[model samples]
Target: MRLNFSIKTKIILMNMGILIPIIIFIYVTITNNLYSNVIKSNIDLLTKESYNTQVYISNYIEKDKGVDIETNFVHKAPLINTYLSKKLNYRIQIYDKNGDIMTDSVANRVTLFDKDITNAIKGNKAYVVKKIDGNIYILFSSPIYLKDATLGCVRYIYTLDIEEKFINNMFIIMGILAFMSILISWLLSKLLSEKIVGPIKKLKTVSQKVTKGEYDNRIKIRSGDEIEDLAETFNVMSESIKDYVESLKEERQKQKKFLDNVTHEFKTPLTAIIGYSEIIPKLKKQSDIDESLVFVKEEGIRLLKLVEELLDLSKLGKSEFKIDRKKNNLKEIIEEVLIIINPRLKKYEIEIIKDLCDIEVLIDKDKIKQVILNVLDNAIKYSECTNINIKLQIENEKVILNIIDDGIGIAKENISRLFEPTYRVNNLNSINNNGNGLGLCICKEIMKKQNGDIKIKSNLQEGTSIEIIFEGN
Candidate 1:
């Protein structure tokens, strides 16, 4: 299996790396200091004893004649060898002026780096550590000066066997303690990492669940630190994402219903146009042929109108749709829409009453007229009245065009979402059923593109009123 280097494991390894070296260095430093102190104390004792022997021989020669007195003193120094050896644990040697070992207090074995007699006679004290018969020892040599004449030299050789054994036992014990400390540090680091990394692991798992669309999963941590802050932020993000997803699903359902309705709306006119065209060609009677031809023409026109409106809606949805705004009179655009609706107004005996003004504004002429035509078309389509009032009034630096019709008005419940894409009034009379349900929606978008707005108010059976607003230059 592949080993995952988790945060817990990393923390443990880092702790051990820092802790083990510190423990080992401390143990080694204390042991070395203790060993050095013991070595220094032993060397001091040996030097004091050696100094006393040198002073005794020098005084004895000063009292008696020279070489004979030194010879007798060298022999006398060895007589106390058993007492010095047992007391100080050192080997002593006395050399004559000729570099000969005249008397030795040690056994047949000697431990020295080189012959110390020649160097000592040249008036230099010498000392060295050497390995003799696989045993480590130190040799210290000092010259005895009698006035200006050299008498002899004294040498002391000693071993640190006892101190070496003591420090070795310290090494073994310290190694055991260091290992124990490392193990304890690793365990403590493990426990600490669990407390630190445990909440983070839970956050990961909950985030994974949220990724898989289970947005309800929340990271519940009580650490009361930055980790808790992270969990709280994560919970908020999940809720936001869930709300966004739900809104998208609702929008998707709306688009689906719109498509179904559009297919049916388009198919109805296409089927009628196709059927009437075939019938007009086959009919023998002139009235029947004329009636069939008129039906074919009307249905074909409606199908074309629906396709054009749908195309306009799509282009408005795009960010790339550009408009050319020029200075124009609002009355002219209204006049254009009024001309389009004149034939229908005459057919329904609906009078067109205009209360407009010469309001000049910056607007796209053709696009603005399309919005006016659509709103006027709805006023004509969904209502029946003897007169349709088209009035324009300026208020608060805005040009407001009000289109009022006394007809079957919309229920208050449906007025709020009247401009939603592909939305239609379900309870419309049979004569107004030819709508594609997106005319008012396109009207709203067109007005918005020109930096304007549309508002509508109506009551059941009373009339509907629509206001188109534009910023006055």
Candidate 2:
């Protein structure tokens, strides 16, 4: 079976694996050196004390002249035992130069059966020994000379169980310390790994969200380090991508609107041209030449207007139409629009009510004129009422113009899309008579260029109000 581990777990394990060996190695090195030094010091102290005790006993025995060695040492055995017992925490023994144990702290007298006694008799200073009974001890011996004649030797024995116990205890403590150190190291590794990997996991999740097209998703990490910097960069990148996508969407919308408007405008003019051209020859026998010429001129003019609007819309779509702005009287501009549309207004029986305000605004004069003409023309074509009210007012440092009429009003559903090119309102009477749907769209664009906006309010069979706002100078 394959092993599966999360990234966090794997990081923890890897860190532990690297750090545990180093910790263990360091602990072992330190503990081994410390324990070795302690044990060696204790052993050396015990050996030195045993050697000194043997030397002291031999010198005292040799000091007596013409005395039986056994009797003299036997009498002093109690004093030696008292001294050795207080100084060394172990059983001590004394042996003669002939390898015969003379006195023992644990026994009155003893025979030299241990190898330590045999070795001591051969003038060994100090040596460690292990008896058959598994007792470990250190023995030291020294010779006693009486006027160049070897009389006897003295031996001392010290048990080593205390040192053994000390070493065993140290081992146990080291084992416990090692285990605790490993545990603490593991825990610390886990914590540090989590701190490092937690943000990475969040980043992974955010990346997946972005991959799924959720460009607005962001990662929040404030580590004050490289990880935090990485998250900040990711957020910036996501925002940039989102902005680019929105810009692309807007461009596509503009392109679609431009194509639809151009198609609609061309279709009407082309149809009129073909229809009039087809009817011209047939009507020649019944119509005067001048009337036919006028009909042709009207169609030609209509086609020319369509071409002009299409070209203007295309230039605007390219973002190449620069506005030539100057301070101008908005009232004078409206008056000029009214004069231009006078023939249409009279023909359509549309009444004009102008509520002009003296407001000067910075705008492109020709562009503002086109905006006014398009909106008023649309109103005159759709309004069933004879009176069309044009209101101008200044408020909040802005010039506001409202063109209202009792027109075949726009439906509620179409009101929102009124400024969308080629999106005509679904009223046949208005659609049949109104200008191309691009009128409102063009007005909206022109108003936007002038640092202004256009808005509409309408209900079916009521009136439609078109409002324009311009920046006041």
Candidate 3:
């Protein structure tokens, strides 16, 4: 079973676990030892005093041959006890050999030291510790011997009130000290726990802020420990997250720009198709009517192509839009494209110089053909080039197809944005041209999906070169 205790709780529990037992053990040990030593020392003192009194009685009995031992003890007991009480501070008692109490300084009080009395009757010295009426005492008993016979026994009763009171006062002081120790331990433990847990808490707060979309928030801790290292790691993670968020924002803005461009591009072709179709029936002269119908047909075809490109782009975004990969001839693909655009090239007085390599490459044949067609079309549209050079070569384990043209080249500024969706170069010479600009964007997307890429390099008034790079066979 796992107990999810907070750091502070765990710290306090652990500290107390160690400290409380130690404090109690020390207090009990010291108190017990002191009490035991005091009792032991007091018993020793009483034993010696009782022995001296017994000797005095023995000598007194020997000197007076006719005196009654009990009567003599009775007479001398008051003075002896008075002197002992004043000098040594203990009560004295005398017991006869038969265990009869002859004298008790406590004034006929019942004896609680029966075990001590029994031992004294056996002619053996004995002592016992006893508590009576909430007060402690030690009773020491010693036998009196006269000529190989037990005459009487001496009993000493010492009150332990002052010793006990002293021990209790010491106990109170120890308890107070223990409490102070616990307080200090608790304060230090808390301070240390906070120091250790502080950085983690800051990290949690900052991480939550980042979770709530505050990517800029970070923890700054300077404890110079593992937690500081953790904080530094957290800060790095925050920076990475911030960078990722920034990239996402830029991508979103680009997508917005693409959508706006799409709107404009679609609008232009639809408008042209609509306008030309509306004007065709109103023309009377045969030449004017033919011209208008031709324009209408051209715009209609352009619109259809634009729609197909948009559909293809959308399908490629889905998981199910897979292409047929087969071994295809690059030479044949180029020849086919050239044949398709042969008439248009001838009409523009453009000559194509093809240096084709007959290499079999694994590719989506149709998609690659589309890319070539788009690039060639762009070259024909914007450039008044009389010559276009096409070359396919294997280099550095890759197939590179280069198309060079001497045409109205793209400006340096427009080269970067050329392959973006619906982004067209604004040609000052031909602003009236109806180019939707989705062609190159579609080509680029198709190449990317096929694990290939397209790159264009252009110089204004000089020429443009388009390189299509693909994995070599």
Candidate 4:
């Protein structure tokens, strides 16, 4: 099983791992050393002051030099107690050389012997004790000197409750500071994580888009750091992908064009062979040898023409048909086409109506002628009517050639596919004699090669018109 942790939780854990120990160490150090130092400094100051006061009183008493020890000392001790008590709010005790307290400031009576005072008297230093009365005190005893000899001891007692309060307050302040520091550190970690991870999240999403073939998408980070360099690289990759896609598209188009042209070229010769074979049996049944010979000759010539067209189409498909293009008279070329197609016109009883206007174009003449012949031959084969109209006009610096035929026209559904290889219009009348369904396809390819286009308009059972437009020089 995997344990899941939220981002915030993980960040908090990491911060705690790093900073919690440091905080603990700092807090411990502050509470122990800092508190001890503060209490020690205060206690030292108070101890020194208490010792000085004791010495001051001891010096005055020893310097008095009075002969009456009991009466004079009693009277003077009360005065000293009253004066010291009014000045210092601490309990002061005067001890004799034998470690018995002689005077007490609080009660103005003889003091009791205590262990802390005895220790202080023996060492001439301060001593600390916690009494059974639940009070902690520091006791300091200084010797009373009389001409460089110890006479007695003055002991001062100070309570430790005030220092304990000071230590408690310091602890509270440190605890509060620790809490604030942790809060601030947590917020800073959160903000820093968001700033760093936000761009990473965006980059992940954009990377997913790129995986899904959206090469146009890009990450737009302006961090001016390594992430910015990554964004620039991503943009460059998108551009490279776009270029590769375009190249693939161009390659596919070229492949389709090649297949279309090759299939069209093969169909023309196959159609010629089939047409001549169909005519052979009929010619054999004729009794007139001359007419039979003439029919055979005609079929043979048609086969030859088909073969030549196939060879030319094959060369062009391979990109080997080198063109020496120059300006040509459009009128003269149309007349030449009329001469070549005259035989078919007579056989089909088709009348040609020409509406030629003065036009000149720069193109490969032979290829243009082939394109026109293919279209006209298709019209003659599919159109059962006797009239075919050819028109040439100039418009917008273009040469437009329209071939209209009164045939069983193409169906609307098939018009779009007419230029696809082997896509025959489903015409029942000319199904057997439809030649190859490649003429229009070849014409379209040739037009495309010359930077021209062919458009068609037709209605079923009415007529068909094909418009070939070429850019004019």
Candidate 5:
């Protein structure tokens, strides 16, 4: 298992990890330095006292005019030790040339034979600081010289009771202050952690709600930082998901309606074919049989046409259904569409007016031809107009092809649904019309796959204008 810590706890731990060691190191260093300075000050004082006492005893022996200076100093050792110890307010000791203690100011006390005393007897001055019976003191020793002759040594033992007490009090005070500083830092860390983690907690809660399909809920962080930017991004993602789901639902409904319309369209022609076949066998007259047979053939053709258009509509926009877009003369393609649709135009007694422009564009040649044919067919069958105009031109760096009719135009409401599958204006269902309502739908899909678009504009009884736009090469 892994351990998980909250932001607040981590922040507190991090502060402690940084602060505790520093506090300890500073405290130890300060305490050691204080002790060293105090010890050094006492050593200096005791050394000075030892030097002065050595000079006083040396002068006193010199004035005695005795050839045995060692004997004279030994006899005067008690007096010198007493006088100097009283003047300096420190304990003192006198040693002979043999490193033996001759006299001490502290009477009947145990003689301390230490390294400092031995160094003084060897004609060198030295001092040492040590603890004895829980009391700290500095022992300083100096060699006493008389006219370059070896005499003896004087030693001083200075107590550091006051300095030790002061150091101890300072250590205690610093420790308490350190504890207080740590406490303050911990509290501040808690507050700071809360300030940082508060918004994050809100973000987590809102995210959980979004996971449960609550797309309307949004974060409201105003920190003016990256966290706020993240909240904005999260809101955008939620909105996108909501929109995608709604589009899917709408698409599913459209699919259901498309299926129902396909079934109805197929059933109508099939029902007519079946009915005409049943009547043909019962009819006795030769004309009647031929007429019935003709009806069957017509319905069969209509049904076949519907199936082919449905197949074309289904393949558009699918990955496997590729559109081979290449540079082609759009004006020539429009002429080809007019030629193919010429027979139907003449049968309807409709006149064609052309305003063609020479321009090349990137598009699938056959698909553009089909889209053009489908639009012209719709115009011939439903527009009820005398003349259909075909125009191609380059406008604003785009190749635009327009097939407009001055006929009984569609309503504004119906124009919007013109590209929808099986959507008809005024429900124009008849044999001559022969529309399964997939022509415009197929045209729209083809234009989209070709990286172009088709749009329609119409007003009831006025006219219909169909615009096809493609990027010019």
Candidate 6:
């Protein structure tokens, strides 16, 4: 099984992992040093007192000439030790060369010589710690030398009550301090973890919301760090996904409508052709039969044209439909399109106005020409205008071609869907145009492939304007 831990918990654990050992080590080190110093201080005091006693004895022997150390020292030992013990606040003992206790300040008859006494009698100083009656004590021993003669040893037995209490109190304080440090570390780690993980939690929440199709949710963080950058990027991703989903939904609606329109367009022509063919055989008059044949032929032609336009639209929508782009004079291409569309213009009694600019650009000549032709044809067929204006110019480092008509124009609401496949504005001019709605759609796809775009502006009964933009030279 996996162990699950929040960032906050991990941070606290890591801090404890580092601090606990250090606190323990510091406590141990400090207490150990303090105890050692206390013991050394007591040993040094005893050595100084032992030296003073040795000097006092040597002076007394010199003052009382002809007096031996054993007789004189033994005679003054009790009084001297009593005074030394009263001054030093320690239990004092004097031992002979044989390690026999000669005198005791505490008046107890103790005969056995311990390690400290034995070492002192060997003409060396020594100290040892011992537990007496559950109380700690330091036994310090020093040798007394009288004019290069080893006279005896003086031992000081000092109670370590004060030092032991001080050490114990220090340990308690350190323990409390360690606890406080741990507490502080936990608090700091918790705060720091919250600072880091707070934004991440918001991101996770927003992500969950986005998964449920709530794309408007966003993270608001301003830590001035990578987390802030991540939040910003996450918000952008949410917006993009929202836009893409909406576009997909819109495209799906358009597809459904396109299918409906295609079915209706096909059905109308097929119904007319089928009705005319069936009725022609039953007609009695030759003139009626001829008219019926004409209707069938016309419907057949319209059906064939619709099929061809649908095929063109399909090809344009595919990835394999590549355009051959080359440098060409845009003015010449526009004039060529006008030449092709002139017959229809004459048929409709429509006058054309041209204001062309000689601009060179990289484009697929055939595709660009076809786009111009489609727009002009739509204006001529649907706009019902007498004058169609064609203009080419450069704007903002881009070549722009505009075709405007002074005829009954499209409604504002219908302009947005003009490039969608098989979308037709339900107006009188649009109904009577008899042009497949895929023309403009194909024009749009071609422009897109050419790294250009098409835009339209229209007002009811005023006119329509088509703007085609291409990358400039």
Best by lDDT: 6
Local distance difference test, each candidate? 0.74, 0.70, 0.76, 0.70, 0.78, 0.79
lDDT of 6 by residue, 122-207 (tens): 89998889887888988888887676777778788889998899999999988999999999998888887887887777877889
Among all candidates shown, the one with the greatest TM-score? 5
What is the overall TM-score of model 1 with all chains considered together? Answer: 0.38
lDDT by residue for model 4 over 1-473, one digit each (tens)? 99987555676779977888898898788778965785577578767776676566656666667654334444566667667767888787777667766678877543545665665556465555445367556665666544545546666776778777877887888789888988988888887766556666677688889888899898899887777888888889888988998999987886665555455443433443454455546554555445444544554565566566555554545675444467888778778666556556766788999898768788777667767777777777776767889999888888899989988887788788877665655554762444455677667767877778999999888988989999877
Residue pairs with backbone atoms closer than 3 Å in model 6 (clashes):
none
Ranking by lDDT: 6, 5, 3, 1, 2, 4
Model 5 agreement with the true structure over 1-473: per-residue lDDT tens digits:
99999868887999999999999999899989999888777777666766777678778888889458878888888888888888988888888888899888898888778998888888998988779999987888899878786677888888889998999999899889989989999999998887779777888899899889899999999998878998999999999989999999998897776775565335545655665665667789999788667767765776786676566555556775557898898888877655444445656688989898788888888667667766776776677888888888878887788878888777687777777777755544322444446667777877888778899988867788999989766
Worst 10 residues of 4 by lDDT: 264-273
Report the C-alpha lDDT of model 3 over 1-473, residue by residue, as the tens digit.
98798867787889989999999999989988998899889877777776776676677666766876656655665565565556655677777777877666767677665799889879888988888789987888888777677766777787889898899899899989999999999988988887677676687688889899887777889888988998888889888988988899998887776665564434434544565566667778999878666656655676676666665565546655556778999899888667555546766788999898799888887678767867877677677778999999998988999999997787888888877676666763532354545667767777777778899998888888999988787
Cα lDDT for residue 425, model 4? 54
For candidate 4, what is the TM-score? 0.37
- Which segments of model 3 are wrong by more than 4 Å? 1-5, 66-89, 195-473
What is the Cα-based lDDT of residue 291 in candidate 4? Answer: 44
List clashing residue pairs in candidate 1: none
Error of 3 at 461 (Å): 99
Tens digit of lDDT per residue, candidate 2, span 101-207? Answer: 66667765444356655655565554545453575555545554434544455555656577667767877886787678768877887777767787888888999
Clash totals, every prediction:
0, 1, 0, 0, 0, 0
Q: Which stretches of candidate 4 lie over 4 Å from their true place?
A: 1-322, 431-435
TM-scores, all candidates, are 0.38, 0.38, 0.40, 0.37, 0.41, 0.39
